[model samples]
Target: MSDTTAYSKKTMRVLLYLQQGELTEHQIYSFLASRVKDEQNSSVLRRIAGEELGHAKIWQKLTEKEVKTNRIKFWFYSLMALILGYTFVLKKMEKGEDKATKAYRSLITEVPQAKQISEDEDRHEQQLLAMLDEERLQYVGSMVLGLSDALVELSGTLAGLTFALQNTRLIALSGLITGISATLSMASSEYLSAKNSGDKNAVKSSMYTGIAYLFTVTFMVLPYLLLESYAVALGIMLVVVIIIIMFFTYYTSVAKDLPFGKRFFEMALISLSVAAISFVIGILVKRFLGIDI
Candidate 1:
């Protein structure tokens, strides 16, 4: 009927996409946690675990009617809904806010509700943006984060392994094995995850994520071959890994546009969880196989 009605109607769909982003992003840390083994990674994962749930909840404020309407499709509906929501509602809200700020005196009187909500939305959006420093943050679209994924996990894994091992050949071998698998798995997951990202930015994000994964794994593993000792190699790897993860947290905060502190805290938790799992695996393997080397 009216422009306002049309906008509101469309928002119902847009909110869905926002929700999906929150839901899917939550998976990265756990998937990685399942792969890495050690204290650092475990600690990272534990932090991530908290962020994932919180992130998901950020856009989870749908009324009962919204959920029931969404439930009708049931399969891939949430994903599609999120895509629409982030693009439409979020963007529109942003636009509406801008329009409200510049609304003419005459129009403001007639469309006061629009003016008011637009201001509120603008404030909300800016709040999200102000939470982080972009320069320090990593670009978290698929590509940026994909690389981040590989870098942190592979680096941490190699670092831990190098810490325990003495042989150079084995160090490289372990990195090689882990890197190849991490790249492929991260690439696949990122691409599939792009289903929710219809925009060009989304596609690029996915590609960046894959590249990040590759670089992350290689960056840490490459050093071990050079240094020759597991301890030295692991030390170098740990420093680099921390730098990378910190960068990733910053990137995610900036790119997704959230608070840096919040992002760091969350990622730290996830890393820890992953490392813990890996440690448990290591313990079991050591006890059962009785392999000492």
Candidate 2:
């Protein structure tokens, strides 16, 4: 009754690899379950963790191999859940699972149970993950509002300042002052808007928006602070802007089931376009005003 002759050596190797991955994911889900505060959410996580273990056991029976969980990935994902919110981590993990799906497809025809497990892994698990209630996700709109405005507005400001002031230190100082004032203004506006809309979490939403805006401002201005050359700082800041766009786009794409490439390109295009236009305006202003500062 052993599966020794059921699969070839190569097939067994693939199954064993999947076995370890499933076990590792199971541990990750279990750890995440322990960290979640909501009892219903915890129950859902535990249910998924049990299913992941069940999938690992299926692979074990097919391969007749004992697998150890990857402790490093376990800890890494656990940390990600804590820092990035469990919904974000799970969405990221689901993307990673796409690679494993190919491996699972290989066993579907060969192993009868593979079909059900594959379906569960691809469809059921994802649906359940989508159902998980995470507070941060609910406030994603506020974060997006803050982050996007900061990126476009501040990137344009820095681009103009770089050309106009032509001094890294001066630009950094000006950008920080501008960014701080804008952050406060943005937070207040969000609070008022949310409150007018009858949102009970108005303060929390504003906090998320302000925090996101401030974080973006800090990154966008960092190059100016570190570098002495205005041109070099501007170039590095542009690169930082693109990176921030990519990271946020990917996060939203996965968590919200949106298209990554389209969102990324659109945001990049708009932000850079604003910067380009502002740069031109800065040149014009500098020439006309004849400011030496």
Candidate 3:
């Protein structure tokens, strides 16, 4: 039998699809590598790009067919790498390869190269990805500091104000004042902490922390600003806090190799627990002071 006849038609189609995918990924990775400022990260991305091209070449030998990379896919992922950090972009791409990996597994008997590529996907690519260093990830602790504090502190503050003020506009005003003050305080604290730790980018760390806190504060406060009922606004604010926690947890999980479910539940539990306690305290304070504002 001819070497080409060894592969079933289904196997040939799969090989062709893998060829196109690998070539497209190669271009995307190469483009991202060029766009990054960090030399180390650039080197890593370039290496991954080369490995992807090598995979494409292996498939080329099997099919004896040339496949062109998809320009549109390369451009789309390049845009994503530019907007979202490359860490997120790469991890998202890795997740997409799960389906391809399963398909390759099915063709391993007829295509030895498929088994090798699958192993590379599971071992080499994942290991290299774990070694990638992105600037945003370097300051993840600062972001966590800001995000956790804002979710816990602001949620509690809003809940307390909801009962104490009993008016949406008044509650929003009070929460804004408190949130602004806390944001500045948290930023200053993080700056000092980073500086004391001898971090060269202390200023940047503080900026990231402050920006994260400020964004969370703005989002959580928006419902109260827009709605007229304090109860409804408070309810919506809590929901927003949960969403922020979920997204951040997921992002951290993918970038840092942490577990999403545990992190998410822990953060949500703490933030909600604080808010619930503060809410009860607000009711007590309102009654004890005979306040009606």
Candidate 4:
């Protein structure tokens, strides 16, 4: 009996969904393979793209139906890969594959090829994904160092300054001066550390670190720069800090395969705790010194 004749309507629908997804992934991988500069990375992407096409063909044979690729998903992942780096986009796709793996396993009894497809999804794809080496990911340590230090130090500094100064302009001025100095310090420190460790990419690592630090500082200090009320600006700056933490933590989690919740909460706790401590100190200093701003 043929697959289309033997399967129910629901099963055929499932096969079609898987088929469309595979074809979309194939296109995304192929596009990335073409765009990637590294020869090895390009080869891996092309190989994966071929495998995805093969998977789509298997589904096509089972369903005996031609289905168009998902254009939206193709463009979305394509744009993301272009902007965020292919390693991140490919890792994110692995999460999607988990769902498809389950779907393939469900059809194993009805479709004999499902078993092999599921195994390939579980093993081969994962192995190939591990082979991808993107430069941005390699400097993740430097980026993390810059981001984490900026969050903890600047968040606390701004909180203290917000209370002590009680003027948005003054707070912003102090924060900018502090942030700029810290950015340079952090960048130079990273450069020296990388060089000392005999890393050939020392300059690149430091640049990433400096850029990450400066980016965080810009958002953290923006509210004070634009707003007149120090209290309101402080509130907004805290929100901005959380947002930055959330975004960076998510990116790292997706790209590095780390647990998101744990990393995010840890960073948030440290930054907020330091801010709270500094805020209290600001209040104490103002009271003890009898200096009215």
TM-score of each: 0.45, 0.95, 0.92, 0.95
Residue-by-residue lDDT tens digits, candidate 3, 96-189: 7777987798788887667867886669888889889898988899999999999999999999989998988988888899899999999999
- Candidate 2 lDDT (Cα, 0 to 1): 0.90
Worst lDDT run of 10 residues, candidate 2, spans: 107-116
Q: Which has the greatest TM-score?
A: 4
Q: Better model by TM-score, 1 or 3?
A: 3
Residues 1-293 of candidate 2 have per-residue lDDT tens digits of 57668787777877888999989989998998998899988988998999899889987877777989998898898997898888888888888877688887887777767777787678879778867988888999999999999999999999999999999999999999999999999999999999999999999999999999999999999999999999999999999999999999988887787899988999999999999999999999999999988
Among all candidates shown, the one with the greatest lDDT = 4
Rank list by TM-score: 4, 2, 3, 1
Those runs of model 4 whose alpha carbons end farther than 4 Å from true positions after fitting are none
Candidate 3 colliding pairs:
none
- Per-prediction tally of clashes: 53, 0, 0, 0
What tens digits encode model 4's per-residue C-alpha lDDT throughout 36-74? 999999999999999999989988988899999899999
RMSD of each: 18.9, 1.6, 2.0, 1.5
> Which ranges in model 2 have alpha carbons more than 4 Å from their true place?
none
- What's the CA error at residue 180 for candidate 2, in Å? 0.1
Q: How good is model 1 by TM-score?
A: 0.45
Superposed model 1: Cα runs more than 4 Å off: 1-139, 144-148, 163-166, 195-205, 251-257
> What's the CA error at residue 143 for candidate 4, in Å?
0.3
